[model samples]
Target: MTDPSDAVEADRALKDKHRTMWALGDYPALASRLIPELGTVLVRACGVKGGQRVLDIAAGSGNASIPAAQAGAHVVASDLTPELMETGRRLAGEAGVDLEWREADAEALPFGDGVFDIVMSCLGVMFAPHHQAAADELVRVCRPGGTIGLINWTPQGFVGQMFATMKPFMPPPPPGVQPPPLWGTEAHVRELLGDRVTDVEARTRMLRVDRFARPEEFREFFKACYGPTVAVYQHIADRPEQVADLDAELAALADRNLRDGGMDWEYLLLTARRAGQAATGPE
Candidate 1:
C-alpha cells in the first residue's frame, strides 16, 4: 500500500499540475463562445430564482454565473485560476451582470455551511484531485433542500475520447485518482452524493462546437486556446512523429463527431437536492 503521506503528496502534486494546465492558454476566449447556452440550461435546472444565493464552483469565465445573476440570483463565481476569474469578471461586466468572483479551490471551498441556495459547476469540480472531497464540499456549503447542478463530459463523448487519445503522450495519473469524467455517469454521481441528497437526476445533452471550418482546423483551434491540448502539443513538440500521430488521431476523432459543419460534444447534466430538514414532530 502507498504510504498515507506519500498519497497526500501525490494528490497535492496532481492538483498543482491541474492548476498549471488550466492556467495555460486563454480558456475564456473559448468558454465565452461555447458555454453560454449550457450555462442557461444549468441555471434553469438548478431552479435559481431572484434573491437566491447561488454559487458557481469552478465557474469558467462566468458562463453560468452571468446567467444566474442575470436571472436575479445573488451569484458568486469561484475558480482556482486568477486569470480565469479575471476573464469572468470582464464577461460579467460586458453582459451587465453583477457577480462576486472569488479565487477558490473545489476540494476546499471557502464558504460557511448551508450558505448557498444552489451550488453549480460547469465542466468544473470534476477535475479536482479528490473526487469525494469535492463532492462533499459541494453538499456541505449548500443549504438543506437546495439544489446542486453540474455539467460533465461523459467518458464515451468526443472530448473524453480526445483526452484518451492524448493519454499516450501524457504521464499516467496518480494511483487511486479517478478520472473527472466519472462524474458524468449516474452510478458514479449517486455514489459521490450518497445519502446526502435526494431527487438525483442526470441527462445527457449534445453541445455543438462549430467555430472551425474543418477537422484539422478544429484540432488547431484547441491547440491554440485549450490548455490541455496546448500542453499536449508542447509535450510532444520535439517528437515530430509523435506530433503527427497526435494530429492524425485528433483529426479522426473530430471527423467522427462532425455534423453540419460542427462537432457534437456530449455531456451530462446532473441535478440533485440536498436532504431537507426532518420534521420535529413526526406522525
Candidate 2:
C-alpha cells in the first residue's frame, strides 16, 4: 500500500519542479512586452468593476490583477511562483496601484469558499498538473452568481502547435497530467466545469503575435524568455541532436504560421457564472 505521506511528498516534489520551471525564464518581461494584453480582454469580458473582490489565479506578473485593480476592483493576484508575484508587485507599485500578491497553488487556492466576486486566469491555471482540481478551485472560491473568466491558447493555435513540436524533445509529464491546451477547447472546459456553472459563453479570439520577423526569431525568443520552452531546451541540454531538432521544428512552426503582418494566436475566452450559492454552504 502507498503511504499517504509518500504521496504527499511526491505531490510537493512535482510542484517544486513546476515552480522551478516557470521561475527559469524571464516571464514577467515576456508577458509585458511579447505577450498580448490578455488580462485586459478577460477583465473586460468578466466586467470587473470597482468595489468587486477579484482573484487572479496563477496570475503571472499581475497581467490580469493589475488591470482589475486599475478598474477599481479589489484584486488579489496569486501564483505558485513568488518570483513572478514579486515582479507584479513592482509593476503595480510603479503604476501607483496596489494588489494583494499571494503565493498560492491553483489546485488548492488559499482562499475561502465563495470569497471572490470574480475569479480569472489569463493564459494561466491551464498549466496546473491537475485540471479537475484547478477547475474546482476556480468554482469553489467564486461566490454564487459571480463570474469566472479565462483566456487560454486553443489546441489548434500557434502556441499549441509549438508545444506539439517540442513534445518529441521533452520528457513525459507526470501521471494524470493533461496537456495545458485542453483548457482552451470549449468542450473540454465544459466537461471540466460540469453543471457547477451557468450562462456558459465561449469565444475564439485572435491575438496578433508578430513579435518575431522570422521563424528562427520565434524559437530564439521563446528559448530565452519563455519558461516552458526554456525548460524543455534545458531538459535536453545534453542531447545536441534533440536540441537541434527542436530548434528546427520550432522555427518551422512559426514560419508557416506567420501571415501577412504577423501570426494570429487563437485563444478561447470563456466566462461563466458559478451556480447559485450552495443550498447550505460549501461542503
Candidate 3:
C-alpha cells in the first residue's frame, strides 16, 4: 500500500494536473454547444429570485451563473480554471448580467459559511479529486434552508460510459479518489449530504448531441475541446494499438446511445435544502 503522506502528495499532484488539463483547451466552445439550457433549468428549479445571493461553484464559463444573474440574483461564479472563469466573465458581460467571478477550488472554497442563499453546480464540482471534501464545501457555503442544485452524469449514462470506455487507455485514478459519477446516484447523494440537508430530490434529463457520420469525427471533436478526453488522447498517442482500441470502443458506445441519428447524453439533476431555519428574503 502507498504511504499516507505519499498518497496525499500523489493526490495533490493529480489535482494540479486536473487544473492544467482544464486550462489547456477552450472548454466553453464545447460547453456552449451543450448544456446551456440545462443551466436555466437548474436555476429555475432552485427557485433563484431577484436579489438572493447565489453561488455557482465549479462553474465553467458561467453557464448557470449567467442565467442566475440574468434572473436578477446576486451571482458569484467560482471555478478552478482561470481560463474558464475569464470566458465566463466575457459571456456574463455580453449577456448584460453582472457577476463576481472567483478562481476557487471546489474542495476548499474561499468563502464564508452560509454566505449564499443558493449554491449550484452544473456538471462541474463532480470532477474534484476529493469527492467528500467538495460535497462538504457545497454544503458549508450555503445558508441553512438554502438550496443546493447539481447536475451530474450518472454512472450508467452516456458520459459515464464514455469515461469507462477510456479507462483502459488512461492511467488509474489515485487511491481514495471516488468516481465522479457517484454524485449522480441518489444513494450516494444522500450519503454525501447525510443529515445536513432536507427535501433532497432528484430527476433525470437527456441532453442530446448532434450525430456525427463517423465515430472518429466524434472522438476528434472531444479531443479538441474536452479536457479529460484530450488528456487521454495525448497519453495514448504513442501507442497505435491503444488508440485503435479506444476509437473502436468509443464508436461502439456512441452507436449504442444514438437516438434518431443523434446522441442522447443522460444526466441526473439533484436539489436539496440545507438544514436550518428558513431565511425570509427575496428568494
Query: Candidate 3 lDDT, tens digit per residue, 76-180?
Result: 999988889988888988998899999888998999999999999999998997888899999999999899999999999989998888888888877778888
Quantify all predictions' global Cα lDDT against the true fold: 0.87, 0.90, 0.88
Q: List ranges where model 2 is wrong by over 4 Å.
A: 277-283
lDDT of 2: 0.90
In candidate 1, what are the lDDT values of residues 1-283, reduced to their tens digit?
Answer: 8699987787677777888899888788788776568889999988888988999999978878999999999999998888888888888898898889998889989999988889999888888867899999999998888889999999998888887899899767776678878888878888999999999889998998887668898788788889989998888899999999999999998888888888788899999988987323201
Best by lDDT: 2
Ranked by lDDT, the better of candidates 1 and 3 is: 3
Residue 217 in candidate 2 has what lDDT?
A: 80
**lDDT (10s digit) by residue, model 2, range 78-111:** 9999999889999999988988989999999989
Off by over 4 Å in 1: 1-9, 278-283
Give Cα distance to truth, residue 109, candidate 1, Å.
1.0
Clashes of each: 0, 0, 0
